[model samples]
Target: APQIGPFSMSDGPANSGDMVSTSCSIVKGDFPVEILWLHNGEPIDQGNQDITITKINKHMSAISIESVAARHAGEYTCIAKNRAGNVSHSTSLTVN
Candidate 1:
């Protein structure tokens, strides 16, 4: 199974137009791991210009928001899956 580690975000509440980012990493897992970001249980829209998803490395993935808006405030989750199994971690974003 895949074990996730060090899932985190910026230190404090974010303001409108502020940039926010988070990272998800797999501490123990098999190869060919798939990582994804979701907002309130729904997949994030990659088509949005302000959103950027990056594969930091083989075991790490990151998502960044160039300009956070009111609608951006919600539960953000990072899910990792491989042939063995899957795991997820979630964090909340507070926009001011």
Candidate 2:
């Protein structure tokens, strides 16, 4: 089985127009694990201009949002999975 490490935010509550980032790491997961980001329980599109995913390393990844709006405030989830198993971590983003 694999585990998704804790979710972390680059900063606390963000104001409208502020840039924010969130990240999670994979543990005990096989290589080529798929990493997905969800906002308010919905998958974030890779082509979205406001949001972007960055691969920090083999086991670490991050999602960044530019000029966050009120709608960006929601529960964010990081899901890491492979053939063996899957794991997830969630955190909340508050925008003012």
Candidate 3:
């Protein structure tokens, strides 16, 4: 079974025009677990201008947004999937 660690934001609350990064870790899973990042229930592209995904290691990954705007405030979800099963973690981003 795949187990996902709790979601975490690099900084506390973010303000408009600030860069933000959110991360999650996979404790145990099949090799080469696939990771997906979603904002407000929609999938985010890998090399989007405003957002990007970074794989720190086989077990850790992060999503970074540059110059966040009001529209960026929402629920962010990190999903890890493998042959055995899948797991997910979510966090809310508030822009001031």
Candidate 4:
């Protein structure tokens, strides 16, 4: 099973056009863990120009937005999965 730890996000209640980021790390899990991001419970598109998702390390991943918009304000979640099971963490973004 996968166990997630130390999920973090940049300072929130952000202003429009501000860059923002969030990250998730797997403290314990099988090798080759896959991490995915969701916005308001919906899958986020990795092809979006303003958003970027990158692996910080074998056990960690991060999502960043070059410039946030009102539509981007919501609950963001990161899910880590492996052959055993899955784990997730979430945070909210508020735009002013």
TM-scores, all models, native as reference: 0.91, 0.88, 0.89, 0.90
C-alpha lDDT values of all predictions? 0.86, 0.83, 0.84, 0.85
Error of 4 at 50 (Å): 2.1
Q: Which lDDT tens digits does candidate 4 get at residues 1-96?
A: 888886556664988989999778888978889999898998887786877999899888889988998988889898998899888899898988
How big is the positional error of residue 70 in model 2, measured in Å on the Cα after superposition? 0.2
Ranking by TM-score: 1, 4, 3, 2
Q: Lowest-scoring 10 consecutive residues by lDDT in candidate 1?
A: 3-12
Off by over 4 Å in 3: 10-12
Please name the candidate that would achieve the greatest lDDT relative to the true structure. Answer: 1
After superposing candidate 2 on the true structure, give the runs of residues whose Cα lies further than 4 Å from its correct spot: none
Per-residue lDDT over 1-96 for candidate 1, one digit per residue giving the tens place of the 0 to 100 score: 788886556677899999999889889989899998898888986686767898899899989998999888888898899999889999988889
lDDT score, candidate 1, position 3: 83
The deviation in Å at residue 77 for candidate 1 is: 0.6
2 versus 3: better TM-score goes to = 3
Prediction 4 global C-alpha lDDT: 0.85
Candidate 4 has its poorest 10 consecutive residues by lDDT at 3-12
- Give each model's clash number: 0, 0, 0, 0
